[model samples]
Target chain A: MKVGILGAGQLGRMLAIAGYPLEMSFSFYDTSGSPSVGFGDILVDKGGSGAKLEEFLNKVDVVTYEFEHLPLELTQKIEKLKPLYPSSKSIEVCQNRAKEKALFTELGIPTAEYRVATSAEELAEAAAELGCPVVAKSVTEGYDGKGQAVLRDVADAEQAWSSINHDAVIVESFINFSRELSIIAARSTTGEVAFYPLAENNHHDGILRYSIAPAPKVSTELQQQAESHIKALINDLDHVGILTLELFETPEGLIANEMAPRVHNSGHWSIEGAASSQFENHLRAIAGLPLGNTAANKPTCMINIIAEKGDKEAILKLPYAHLHLYGKEERTGRKLGHVTVQADSYEELVWRVKNVATFLPGSPEFISSIS
Target chain B: MKVGILGAGQLGRMLAIAGYPLEMSFSFYDTSGSPSVGFGDILVDKGGSGAKLEEFLNKVDVVTYEFEHLPLELTQKIEKLKPLYPSSKSIEVCQNRAKEKALFTELGIPTAEYRVATSAEELAEAAAELGCPVVAKSVTEGYDGKGQAVLRDVADAEQAWSSINHDAVIVESFINFSRELSIIAARSTTGEVAFYPLAENNHHDGILRYSIAPAPKVSTELQQQAESHIKALINDLDHVGILTLELFETPEGLIANEMAPRVHNSGHWSIEGAASSQFENHLRAIAGLPLGNTAANKPTCMINIIAEKGDKEAILKLPYAHLHLYGKEERTGRKLGHVTVQADSYEELVWRVKNVATFLPGSPEFISSIS
Candidate 1:
């Protein structure tokens, strides 16, 4: 089968790599002229024009986007021509915080309390009403902590609103959570769903730096709670591929932070940790193949290589470290690659993850359920 | 690193897949006009001329071949310009049975008693001396049960010799063996070696149909014996990549049958069974990186999908079965792909293997140490 990806980034590259063994070929549509996915037939449609998009659509049997923030018109057009997994409605919802929050509310999934604001005065009022230290984020096109600011007090709302610079923003009460976690689940075209165990995540500078799968010390109840919420979202949207819901473990229960309408970084550990990788399962779901096992094979940790790869040889020396470079050049805060470390026990996995982290410059200290 | 593969077959395709995650790019030189490896910078060097060969060599930082039957002159020529792992000497030794047996003898490796014959008269005499029921194989360019014939009586020697139709042949007494096994080992440029567990293989019509890794009931002594033999060969050749030694487990001990200087079919199980796969380790070795852990993650069995894939959906539905298609058209007796099934216990693995085999048309009954 031929698959066309809307964004030719690392996620698309990994999806192609995973799908190749299934005898699936890929053609990547790079909206950004500089495509980092070094292989595959890449069409650079910088202008998102007529001929190139038509050519890409003609080449593929199905369509999926790695990035959710793509132009809605393009995805809708592609959907008209070919089957688009997760659908354009998924994109429309995930790209806007207000719509996403409304979906969570409609599905009875718990999320952070929030109010939409269209002006600085309204933002200040919402922050005052929600209580101080709220996070004000743009209603749309926000990711990786961009288009966001913190309101320590109601007085800081003006600066926060100006920093966000969007006509509308959502002011959410920041929940003081014990930890951050994410659940990745895949839904097939036949509507069969499989959920990977919750992964504990650690972010530095608003970028995911570490993720440990089967999140150490997670109880059956907690995992089920996370799974049920994501399942509701997936079923509600009639999602056809992977859908990720980021959550915060608070005193009350798991509260949804956000959802990504595609394969996520926190699920990257599945490449080595679980029986089947998220990338592979995502492809399998869209291709109408049966979903693979989602159980964790071992205690595994994925350490992101951001900005620079300090020492390739040192990391390679760690026998358990499975280094995956995206074939992207070095740049500040750019995710060049990731290394997955697995062990018989979480104790050993932590030590090995720490060993690998030492070779990645600017890597945050290893953090997870056990550490 | 840029890796140029000598053949664009399934092995080279898998090598490219494994190496891409390590930030390595691939270019494949297909001496045959038809290249099955679906992806990569494929250069069809059917003419074996100077310019195409030079272009291929120039594009790669290192070189390796998936198949050993390539023209030695071409390999040696490429070796002069690029660092070809396992070297031309490895190819020289592997392509000729006489030289391979001689090397085995020099290393004190046990094998079936054999003699070289130049003509039908010599072959008949050798068969008589060895007692009848001997197998005669061409001294060079033989693989997958090709260029061989068996003699049940002394009078059949001329027919067997004529059937082989080679200038020189090796006549050996056919020994009754308990099972066929193979050990895969990788040696790094730094001379560090790591060995994967021995795989118990079952062959049908001279093609490998199934392989069970860490070969069930293998005593520590037996594993060490197999490892030692492979290590000796790797060291003798100063090999810098994967070296596979196929063995016949007899009443006495293991007897060396043959060797391949690149990744072998039996090691395909490592892709999902071992902590590190043979293909990945092979690339790591050739790229001058440290070898990965070669320990089996679980009791695993690999069932080759010969000729035709019966039911892809059925295989995919088997959660533990990792299906790998080579993207080749179905042909009688051709290896199209394989499915790796893993279970926590040997008994469970055997059952799973049998379950997976049922969906593969014409698959031989599953056989292994446990079964």
Candidate 2:
């Protein structure tokens, strides 16, 4: 079988790797043009001459993607010939903050109360209703904490207007929280559900720094609340692939900050920690197959190595951590690799993972103390 | 870091997968062309031509292998340039039955009594001394139960001479073994040892059919004995990388049946079932890094899913059993994929593994009864 991938990034390369074993072939349509090109025999298609792109895509059996930011029209066009997972409509709703907030309100799902702002005057009113210290975000194409800012006062709110640099933005009340957590799950066409354990996350510069599965200190009631909210979203969306919902654990209760409609970085531990990984499960769901178990094996904590390795080979010796690299060419601050460390207990897993990078000589001081 | 891999087959593909995260490039020099070309950029070298082979070998900083049938001359040549794991002596011993028996004798490692037969007259005398129900095997190039025959009487033993094709054969008493088991371990140059739990194996038509980790009924004493013997072999050979000891469980204790100088199939479960997988550990050993813990996370049973899947996609949906495919184009009885299932206990694990294949409706009739 042939599958057409919408992007030629690392995720696409990994998809090609998974497809190879199933006797499936892939053609990658990349925007970057230099994605792990030599790693797999992935035919590159860059909308090369309108006719050529169509011709290459025509030869495949299905279409999928690595991440969002795909043109909705391009995806819709591809959907006319074959299925596009998570559907272009699903992508449309989740891609922009404004659209996502509207959908959540329409579905009666609780979200940070918000409104759209077209100018500075609009920000004051939205913030007035939403409350001070609200978040102002570009309605579209923002990720990793970019294109967004917090409004603490009238002057702080003024900066939100110039920063959006677009026709529209959304202002949301910032929830006071104890910690941040996320739920990574997959839903099939048949509504079959597979959910990984809640992973507690800590971030730096808005990029995920560490994630540990089966988040400790989480009450059973909180976990159940998180799952029900996630199931409601997947069902409401009629989602057909993996979904990641990042949430805040507030004193009031669990409240979702946002959601991603694909395999997420925060779920990396599943590759070695779970009975079956989110990657394999995503493939299974996409292939119209049943999902594998999402149970954790040993207590596992995943540490992002960042683009910080001056000599990446230093990690070749880490005792209990499993390393995963994206096969991308080097550049400073690029997400080069990750290490998943597993242990007999959650504390030990956390302890070992936090100290792992120090083992690599000439390694930077990126790791933060967990204790 | 540089990783030199021997025999570029599917195992090399897997090693490449394990190596990518370290940013450590691999050079897989195959006597037959680059076998893992589909998954990684494999630089092929022509073995029949001497200069081309040496040029290819010059590219890698170290060497490891996917299969053990290495050309002694080529290996020796490569050894002059860089280290060859398992040592040339271990390869020489494993390559021939006569030499292997002699090494076992010298090492004081126990084995079934046997005699070398190079002629039909000698074959008769060997069978008489060992017993009528003796097994005859060609001394070299024997694997997956190939080039071996079980005899019942004098007439049956006479045919063994021709079956051996007059090549050197060993005549030995058939072992009354309770089960087949294997011990996989990695020893670094620093003398640190890491051992995977013993795994019980079941074979069909001479190929490994399945493996059960933490061998269900092995006593603590027997487990320790198996580990000690493996450690001694590693120290004796001063072995590097991974060493897999295939053994037979007898009434006395575990007896060494064969040894693989690299990762073994029985240890594949470590990918998800242990703190670190054998593949990851092998790379660690050769990279001159520390070894990871090998403790099993739960009772695990990995059942090989042969190529005859009625519908490969449909059957791959099992919740707990992680599946790995060799990327080989399928054929009758070919090794297409394997399913790994885990549970809290051995009995439950075996039972759960049996039903794991129910996800594949196209599987054979017996699959339902013996997943």
What DockQ do you compute for every candidate structure? 0.80, 0.45
lDDT of 2 by residue, B70-98 (tens): 77887787788887775676677667778
* Cα lDDT tens digits for candidate 1, B1-371: 99999889999989988988888989999878889998889999776655578788889899998999878887787788888888999999999999999999999999999999999999999999999889999999899899999999999987888889999999998978999999999999989899999999988888999899989879999999999999999999998899999999998999999999999999999998886899999998987788888999889888889988889999888878899999999999899999999999988988888778778875745333237
DockQ score of the complex predicted as candidate 1: 0.80
TM-score of chain B of each: 0.97, 0.92
Model 2 chain B scores worst on lDDT over the 10 consecutive residues at B362-371
Report i-RMS for every model: 0.9, 3.0
Residue A267's lDDT in candidate 2: 85
> A117-157 in candidate 1: lDDT tens per residue?
99999999999999998999999999998898999999998
**Model 1: CAPRI class:** high
Which runs in model 1 stand beyond 4 Å of their true positions?
A: A366-370, B47-51, B366-370
Which residue pairs in candidate 1 collide? none
